[model samples]
Target chain A: MSKGPFKLERAGLLQLLQALKTQGYLTLGPTVREGAIVYDELHRLEDLPIGYTDHQEGGSYRLEQRGDGAMFGYNVGPHSWKRFMHPPILRLFRARQANGDLEFESEGEAAPKYAFIGVRACELQAIRVQDRVFLGGPYQDPHYKARREQVFIVAVNCTQAGHTCFCASVESGPRAQTGFDLALTEVVDGEHSYFVGEVGSEAGARLLDRVAHRAAQEAEWNQALALVDRAARQMRHLDTQGLKERLYQSLEHPRWQVVANRCLSCGNCTQVCPTCFCTSVEDHTDLAGQVAERTRRWDSCFTADFSYLHGGSVRVSTLARYRQWLTHKLASWQDQFGLLGCVGCGRCITWCPVGIDLTEEVAAMNDVQTGRFAPKEAGGAHV
Target chain B: MVSLPSPIVVDPMRPRPFRVARVMRETADVVTLELEAQTGPPLRFQPGQFTMLYVFGVGEVPISISGDPQKPERLVHTIRKVGAVTEALCNLRKGAVVGVRGPFGSHWPLEQARGHDVVMVAGGIGLPPLRPAIYHLLHHRQDYGRVYLLYGARTPRDLLFPEELKRWQYTLSHAPGATPVRVTVDRAEGDWDGAVGLVTSLIAPLTIDPSRTTALMVGPEVMMRFTIAELRKRGIPEENLYLSMERNMKCAVGFCGHCQLGPHFVCRDGPVLAFPQVRDWMTRKEV
Candidate 1:
């Protein structure tokens, strides 16, 4: 509980997980699965992706050995914290018909308290972005709010930046700033391996008290800070100055059509996006017509059905769908939520099949805006 | 600093049961149904707000409230047989039960247009969504300066609430208020004597004070755009004009992100929005 940057040994992390478990929280952290690092249930410290790092680029991701045996060596993977918070599939309610009258029942299962271990800085910002989306709106999503309120975040400072990462560009990452219970900066200095932990909340202090820790030395604290600073410097740059206005004014920009040509409209980017919260509902009924349930699932704007009306889909072309997704992310999101939608985790870039980088797209749009580049004729392609 | 779970007072996604009290066929493809809540209180809504109507086995659709705002006892929805959900809704018999999650989105600026000249333009099936607003204006007729109802449909057969439209025209004609009901059709047939033109044609002929007029419209996006242009040419400010927008909706209460028109979620910030607020968004194609 002292105002000290506490130092915890490698074994201290195992005890920290045990403390969270004793506090009745389901510990979830990164693990190697299906040739990629994904967040899943973590029962032991070994479940952490130790000595493993991810090589992420546009349309590509591969796990690599860090060799230093650092616990939190990688940047984000395809999976975001939203997978656990706002699940891909959830049953909203169920109804049964009795004597020609319908009786509705809410699926009232209690939301589980989650101790999210190894949460990256950008993912923390992503969680905050979703907080405004599901809870800050006029109508709070009961399911989302329930789960989010009980979440105990353990944010990890990124000591290494992936090729796709631009959290520094968006000013959301490389170092955990706020909105976490405990912020950890992993220091793998030569033969010494430990974590410099900063308690962000009373709960964090209490949890740290239960673990083996000591006041971090000035040299150790500086080493951890330097590592995070080095990671920040390695990030790709995205000029956000007038970005909203640029995207809005460039609605007819030929670059959209150019991008749409290569864009598959497969919605891989949306799935990996931490802040994309669009969803659709499905209704199912029993064969006997006695019961019916409505299930909500994550939906992508890339799909034609996402904009369907009585006559037809509003956004018919892949050009329009792609335009909708990007515009909503960079421009309209500010108007809607008073915050930029993209956290610059670069999941959209890493997971896009055609390797479309948004930073590069914005740069192209900037060139057009400045009249420095005149796009060649797109042959009657409409944006 | 451990926070306890908040009590779940209500789940917005859950729909309340409503029984079909009466089904009045308006056209071959459209029908108006009166719904009464089976257990709870009636769904009270403003003139322009809409409800998410759910057919048991089928899907749900966002349908505007067609009943009078003053009379909240019997909820009415004028539905056209378009998709599978609306098809099920249109074919519902009396005593049949359906789920309704409602009274969402912004309403017509009735309070702002109280003393101003009210100009209402409706095209095709859009008339039903505007009926509740017309009722409000008529119920409090003395509060407004001038009231105009300009309606257009594909044909005379396609016009909704034929009997009620006639009654409204007759009653407003004899009253002290300056109320006029102008009807038009795209292509008149079978002894149809109405003006043969688009709804925009009706706006040009109306004598409205530009400063005092508050134009409200509900229809196809193209129709609304044209009507807005006509109204603008008449010197009405963009902010004074209102329109009811339609979009694909899942959660009627802004949880599902389907009903977004630019930054505004049609279910929350709109469904009814001032023209100036959505001018840029409306002009953008496939936004």
Candidate 2:
């Protein structure tokens, strides 16, 4: 276990990633797909977002061309690493009646060892947040832990920031500072002509040792730092200080109602959010009526059926539902989970049908409360 | 860890081992069961709290505790043949075994209600949850001010605890320190002597000290709306007014989102709530 900060030639990056894929592990990385850079299954280095850089801002996203063709060129993606690890839907247990007796078997078999590639700093923070919920909560979610324990993390320092991105505001972005087995900063066409890689764990060091990497010099580290700073500068910033209090204090504030108007309540925001883990369980007997399985599927509070009661839905209006969803995400989550819900992934704003930006909503709420945008005469100190 | 008074609010073993001590047909569709704990100790649950009555092979349904919580060892439950689980529960024999989970949910604040006027209102089988509170008030007659009961039934025959009500009314009217009982029926016949109107009408002449007294209510949502409204007219704040709620509760544990009410887990946070605290979310459909 040598203390190592290794370097990899830009051209050899593809061969190293391709080799890792052949060993029965799903090599997941940022790839250009569905008009967005998203994390998904990758088999070869060709799937990497090579020669591509991303532009991100509130309520917008675009891809740009880069002069240097680097394998890790994009910032964070719409799809996160959780999709491969903590899948939205999972079968918790299967029950079958054999000889008139109930047999319940927990479904933890065949959990795969996924080599998650190109995880971003914000995305890494999201993973840790989920770890608190799945592993550090009252009951250990066996499914999540099983998949998480068998996985490998490869983080790529962001070189680009997407529109609708605000990881900078939440203080969890633009650089893979820690929480990854192997952290890489793309430095194509430079003197090193390679990735400035830092290993954070024994597994990361072992993997790096398998690849042909040279000792990174002081100039390599300086170049790597410049790239991270450039990405951070591109990020859309929000004043997140006192954000939790500001959001909760204004539950009845007009901004929530305003945001609700644009919200379609289609639940795409939660679906794409890396940290949202609310789920609904369904128990159904199979065709033979001899076996039954309880399957948990990703559920969003925005769903009308999510809060359905005997007589009707709790949040009958889309406005009420949206308010509840956002407030819970940014404000009350701190009260319940002891942490801010948003990890600044920007997926919610990007995936929103109307592109409702939370950073904008917070700013509006603050203005509305402080009389910043009032008619000047219609204002007194708000309670 | 001040010894979380009740460590397991929703015990894994629901519908605790209660053997049917007696079963009687209350109506063509409903039955009342006198249950005796088959194992260990009886449950000391609060009024308004419920249990997941489990019929081993069938399933589980949330049923209110109709029996005395004080004499928990010998429990009682009433069920209407509505859903599969309820039908299974109604079909149990006097000797059949059943599992129970709970005494879950917040109960009427009995200690807080002491030394204050107490008003209880019930509709249909909602009587079961209210019965415990009614019984508790009667047992401790001198603890509070006026103790009035306003009850409503869908029809004369749908009335539960008919014999018990008569005894309860007599106890209140004759017990040197008791309060009067007000009763009503939605549809009445056969020379019924009680008021024939919605239960809300009974609260018009009723005495309620909103700031000081506590009002406990249970019924269909519509009935509760009107009943609680009457209490408000009588100047009772939502906090002092409480109600018991029922929904499709799959797991008595807080893990399931089926019984969630906003930020609260109805299974854990409350089946009973301070009206003001829940009034906003209560009207919000599923909550």
Candidate DockQ scores, in order: 0.47, 0.14
DockQ of 1: 0.47
Give per-residue CA lDDT, model 1, range B1-287, as digits (tens): 23533433357788899999999999999999999999878888899999989999798899999999988999999999988999999999999999998788899999999789889899988999899998998898888877889999999899898888887885545245534889999988999987999889888888778899999999988888888878888999888999999999999777778888888899999999998778777777788
Model 1: runs farther than 4 Å from truth?
A190-192, A370-383, B1-9, B173-179
Which tens-of-lDDT digit does each residue in B45-123 have in candidate 2? 8877887776544556678888777788777788888866688888877776666656677788999988888888888
The weakest ten consecutive residues by lDDT in model 1 chain A span A373-382
Model 2 Cα lDDT, one tens digit per residue, A1-383: 46666678755566567666766677777789877788778767777777777666545678777766667766665688778667877776565565534445567478877888888889888887777665553445556666787678888887667767778888888777778888888776722347888888887776676678788888888889898888788767678777766664565676666777778789888888898877776667767777666666878878877766545666677777777777677766676567767887788887676878887877877775542212111011111
Residues A1-383 of candidate 1: C-alpha lDDT, one tens digit per residue? 45578898978988999999999999999999998999999999888888888998899999988777788888888899999999999999899999888988988799889999999989988988898887776677888878887899988899989999999989998899988888999988654478998988888988988999999999999999999999999989899998888887787899999999999999999999999999999999999989999999999999989989988998989998988899899999999998899999999999998899999988888877543223222111223
Best by DockQ: 1
